[model samples]
Target: MKKKFLGLLIFITTYASSQTYTTNFNVNTNNKDIKSIVDIWQSYLKTNSKEYWNTAETKDLKNFNILNIEGVINPSLMNWNFSNLILSVNLFSEDSYLIKSIFEGENKSVFAITNVLAKKENGNFKLSNYLFDYTKNWRSHSSENITYFYRPDYILNVEEVSQAEKFYSELCKTFNLKSEKLTYFIAKDCDNIYDILGYEYIFSKGMSKECGYYEIQNNYIFATEKAGANHYHEITHFINKFYPNANYLLLTGVSAYLSGEKAHFGKPLIYHIKRVNEYLEKNKEISLSKPFDFYKLDENTNPQYVIGGLLCDLIIERQGKNGLIEAFKNTKSDEEFLQFLQSKVLKKNENLNDVLRKKIKEISKTDEFPNRLKN
Candidate 1:
């Protein structure tokens, strides 16, 4: 006879003045091993939960000492493969509550944890309690914020659904530098995205190649991807949206580089270089002479995404991150951004046309357009 076993689980929640988190489980299984594990967890709560809660940090959340957690469980959602547990706790000095809902259903579950930070008393944010609700009423309220982007249709690994929420949480932290209300959607494809965002397709990825698209629309970013959901790269474009004066070359190139480099799109760096180089070779005259013009796509034209992406990396190498960031903030028009870049970084009395032309030549390692004078 084979031993029947359910997956392992641990859900904890902590509350205000307690500095610690507590967890409750709703295990659904006749398996002895699963039941034994569940019993051990319950025993720990009976023995050490109070001790853990007392030692929890009474001060700010960032500095707070959080033990395991304290909360109730929802038994209805519990199954051999799926478990839904809710942990509610009070936080800081405020009377507000923080709710953490941990759902491990199927391969991918949603870890929706909301911390209600209230600074009403002494302007100091206090600890709040936790609650779980499948209805999602407390998400928009309770001083809680959610920045999530999800595409249920595109989800292949159902076991990793929680990853989507986790990725969105990181994006909020990295780009916004703080938590905010966020939600993600699933579109049928790139074309379905157009109805929501009025962007004409400037350039799209090859049909065989899996790629992500990030574009600025009405000073906001609208991203479209075939499968790989890269929120970080798309959010970068959203952040840079404030810089209307930013160069298109910087926009596309930096977005791509960050998508591949910072966000780790799994594509080797050389792959990007080769793609850009191939496109440059095929469209030598258009790319070398005029990058901005080349990016404008028609039935016959190819997008300058790779060229732009490489240029962004070049700028980062030449100018520090701060310099590039400042460039985005300072420039408001294409001409202005290019002029600002040239004046700030290049040789004295450098002609814009010559500077751009030479820059491309140096990077590409070929002067395909030597006959064409830099105007």
Candidate 2:
């Protein structure tokens, strides 16, 4: 879940005041566990979530209370300023509980819901995530680049670790970052991803039973097997490590460029390009630069991926990674990014949309197998 461009999520018409955020929930407030949780949520509602975590801060357990907001999310990026209200709480056990809530987001039409686990911590209940708890019984093996987490019943073969190590080493060279041990949580499917990330379920971004999500600030990679051991998409996010200034619209494309594949959809970049080409053939006049929501190419495919990926491919092929590092470091605005492209590397790409399709043609002929990995 890159939450890149158009990370817009749900909004219900209902609204609530700060003190009322936890007032209406039907949990047993009299219980110490519930009371502790109520205090946590009330404080969260009263404060702007942005105050809880900074994407650029150096994260550590000692710093977690100040930085890692929760096991799930910092806040909805678009709805960061929106209000949240607790609707209900269900006790899963004396120590574990489920919470449901709505965010009265900036958008008023679409519906969004969020859920988190509340469990006793140090004898005081706090809003929590199941990431570590869910993995308490899981086994792990360390590699040169990755620390793999999965069920003991699962076979994490040697090939997987080798491939993951190769991807990590390549990305380290690509980013010029000193190599550090990576924390990877590999799972059977996206449900494991959601549960590990402090979600019972999430409705705002819509759910995919399979996907890859990167929590870069904490260096956690939640990926399904479909994402593969060499998941350059989410891996790119962690390796980059510089999120505050990341042009995510471009970063999303960069992720596509590096990963060379899509999770869940489980297709390669060229596979998606062929699908988008079919979409373009139907609407010949459609513009990729403009508001192109024709994302319905498939249930899980997003157009930015293929188009952004191609654009990234073009920039890299034309001017190399340093060129991209230039654009990434300096270009902040989307329009600014395009302007940088036009000024620096726009030879055959003057008509960006057509060129993206043309580039796909160029790639399809020789790139059926992602040659980038072979390098």
Candidate 3:
């Protein structure tokens, strides 16, 4: 944790150049294991193939687990957006290693660091993930709907555990889908979760340090919140599974609609709507077309979630559950989505942005936003 790559100097001049591609593989001497490590890594850098990504992991696991865990997939040093890459290898044993990659940004000292574990294999080496090794010592608790994993030293929130089980059943019943046991992992803070999963320090584009990801197919959640099964925002992510054929982005809106910042994190979706409205008022030119702003004015909030939730609110308000399901299952393209929104919410002459701003402002005035799931 706290960026463990020590004594690895990054020369900033290379990052200042244009589209310059190279690999700085640093190793002390020529040993068989080190040779294999260099060979496998250089091969990966050259072809950027899936073969390398797959075999680089431990015997029974794939490196893609890290992809699902961290949400950062770097296949090669060939990214056009970054200036240069620095790769350092630290061998824990002849059979184990931790590979750290520091991607230097062109603009400033800002760089993104990612990690992978290299294990010696058949006189060579393969890249593995840090997750399984990290979680081996952790404790677990099983309920009717969740299998919870946590650090041994952590105090289990039994109340939240019960709430999580209750919420899971409620959500399943509301969506008319069978409830499945979710594999939920908890950490004290997000940064701790990152550390256990091979992330050191991630610069949040100079914003808040909030970051986390979940494995949808596996129904695995790696979160920092003690809310566990009671995690409303994340539990609502199951809507995608219920409507597998639905637009995923819209399903995310559904999740944001149900929980957003409330249910455990305090503020409601209306809280975000208010802050975003203030942001819209000051920016003046912010349009509905650009509704997915990553730099959303509120803490850990963005426009896509806010706008889309508002759209969900309007759809359900006008059309109810069946109509909302229709939009979820049928609305595929952005064109279709906009037209659907236009038909449902737009007044005679108002543009999509105009209507969206009005709804956002109206919702902001209320202390609480309507959650259809609660019905």
Candidate 4:
């Protein structure tokens, strides 16, 4: 009985210690190299600990259904005394998916790591973490390729350059943006853009991805790829950068209004318009309600852009151009944006029910409302 109890105690201790990974592997490659890598990971885990998993930026990192990190190393060839050694790191995540790199270190060196995602007790793969180099060059990650110039005044290459330019020009005018300072780019990889700008407005490449906030930076937008005029949606996101933490409810409606983009699923025009009119009538009184879950519908719901745009237009009509701009420029969290709107825009006795009804009646009273739909 004494022997069995001692054995059980030893087993429990081992299990508890194994719950956290504290092992380190020093490669024979180079002392400086290995130490550098370790430093980066150590610093990152310290600042971005499991606690940050709940923050808006890396909430997904806390998914917790992942495997242990597998391998990490340097991939970039360019190096100086210490710069080149740090940039190479490749990490693999859940399902053995390769998540390339994360920059860490004193100089913010880039590392590419490979991870093998762990499975739950049920035997399905999930993400672990990354593995990469620390023993080499750290500055190799800071190249023009990794830099994004955010001058919203610049031009971008897309399908309709002229139309896009015109659209941006008008939007800048409406929002008091200095168009000469706007810089833009067209890139295929959102991850790359995220690294450069610390934020991105990605139009996804496939299904299974819907429009939502992506952590490429703490708050960036990624839209559905199939959008006909994706730039409009993305630029609206660009405009929204001015209002970080503004509620998606207000942001969505306001952006759609500013960019003249509409909500679209796979649906016909007239059918979509009718659905919009119905949704507008049903939720007209719920100012926050209409904009909050506008994108939460399923396949049966067609292009909601028309209605979404209209809703934003109604806001502009009520608030005026400067009001919209002030909403964007306002410094507040997601909750504060809503609170301000409640106190200022939707003050007591200013019944949105009557306001919306009158607004809708006035909007629908003219052919201009439908004419705006001719995108």
Best by TM-score: 2
Which residue pairs show collisions in model 2?
Answer: 1-213
Q: TM-score, each model?
A: 0.42, 0.78, 0.76, 0.45
lDDT of 2 by residue, 1-375 (tens): 332332332223323322235445466778776666666766755663423332232134323322133223434322344455666777866677766665554443323355556666555556554455578798888887688888777777778679778877877777777777677888878766665555544553345645666665556677787665666677777645554554555676677777655522567777777767777777787776542233445555677777666766677778887777776786666667777777887775477666776776666566462533235
Q: Write the per-residue lDDT of candidate 1 for residues 207-284, one digit (tens) a residue.
A: 212223332232122234444333445544545545566665566555545443333133433344444455555664
Please write out the lDDT profile of model 3 over residues 294-365, one tens digit for every residue: 234545455666777877777787788777888887767656777776776556786767777888888788
RMSD of 2: 4.8
Candidate maximizing lDDT? 3
- Runs in model 3 deviating more than 4 A are 1-25, 44-63, 68-86, 104-110, 121-124, 178-181, 205-211, 226-229, 241-249, 260-266, 280-295, 298-300, 344-351
Candidate 1 ranges beyond 4 A from true positions: 1-179, 192-225, 261-272, 282-284, 287-290, 296-303, 348-375
lDDT of each: 0.38, 0.60, 0.62, 0.36
How does candidate 3 score on lDDT? 0.62
Between 1 and 4, whose lDDT is larger? 1
- Distance from true location, Cα of 52 in model 2, Å: 10
Shift in Å, residue 368, candidate 3: 1.5
Better of 1 and 2 by lDDT: 2
